[model samples]
Target: MHSQNNDKKIIKKFNESESLVINEFDKSGIISFAQKDVSNSFLRGTSNDFIEESTLYWTMKFNKYANDFFKKLTSDKYNFNQGMLKVFKNDMYEENNSKNYLLINSADDIKEMTNCHLIPILKNIIHAPKEDMGLLAESLVHMTLLKRKFSIDQEETVGGAIVVVIISKSDGFIWKEKKQYYSNESNKHLEYVNYYKSQ
Candidate 1:
């Protein structure tokens, strides 16, 4: 959705930073990714094949973003798993169902959904107006976060929790960017606070 000049500028910036730029376009919006920004630790035990690795990275990024968002905001100890993230998008947001929750309805035919769970997303995307991609992305991420939290508190697996979402509206412009070290320190401090508060 960007102008040619803007695209050029993006490419130039990535070139300068020695980062691999990946641009994916869908009806919802464009996803621009920099390979370097993705953490290698998140790729642990994942496939080595390029396509498989990228798919895992994308999924992990969603988990990472959600985890990063809640790094210090809560006392709950849990993680957002990939299954919960999938349910958030596929079941709640109707990603794999009717696709009606999409910001743009350009498909030839929307899939007919018989039994939808209809779990409410953090931000109501039922009739969201399309203007800013960053807001849309953030809302989706938050929805995943909420789902993962529920899974951790109630679900059997891991007795827990993951999802990452990112957006860069402009060059060097990260949407709600939280530095890695800052998040780490905040999480540690919160651990101490949670211990003392519990005591």
Candidate 2:
């Protein structure tokens, strides 16, 4: 309950701290790609809008399990099961008409899994440094393919991956936006050394 003059000073300071500036020189770019033929592997990947929507809609319902998966991968601390993921199309997570849910299985079911399992790759991408995102995405996908003994150049198998990296101002400003797509179908692998490579 300070004087109005103090409140004015606080307001002024807050406004000065709120710096959002965008001009014609600003640009935004999305770098992403995916492998071809998604039916051959026990894993699946998606990125960009699909991932964004899922992150927003699922929130904790999905993130808690994803965090567990990440912990298991990064550290052997959690005894979480690393098994195939299954997607159910039903509206099971209908809290206020929200449709988002995930179910996990035991580790014993890993080998016989025939469906395209969803990896905790999104958690990795979400927590990755902004500059390392592109290479990280490609590297993770390539590594997964290597695990299946798939060629990086041939046999577009059922295993696929997509990673979306968007470059923009750290303060959240946009003037121009661009998207570049790379995939096995196009014979292009999505690899960028830095944030500005796509820009």
Model 1, span 1-199: residue lDDT tens: 1123432343344234322212122122223243222221121111113323343344445545655554533434655565655555445423412332221121111111100111122123334543244465544345444544576554332112222234333223333443331354535655664577689
Off by over 4 Å in 2: 1-34, 37-119, 140-166, 171-199
Model 2: weakest 10-residue lDDT segment is 99-108
User: Which candidate number would show the highest TM-score if scored against the true structure?
Assistant: 2
Instruction: Score every model by TM-score.
Output: 0.21, 0.21
Candidate 1, TM-score vs. the true structure? Answer: 0.21
lDDT of 2 by residue, 61-114 (tens): 454565455555545564544442212211222322231122111111221231
Quantify all predictions' global Cα lDDT against the true fold. 0.33, 0.36
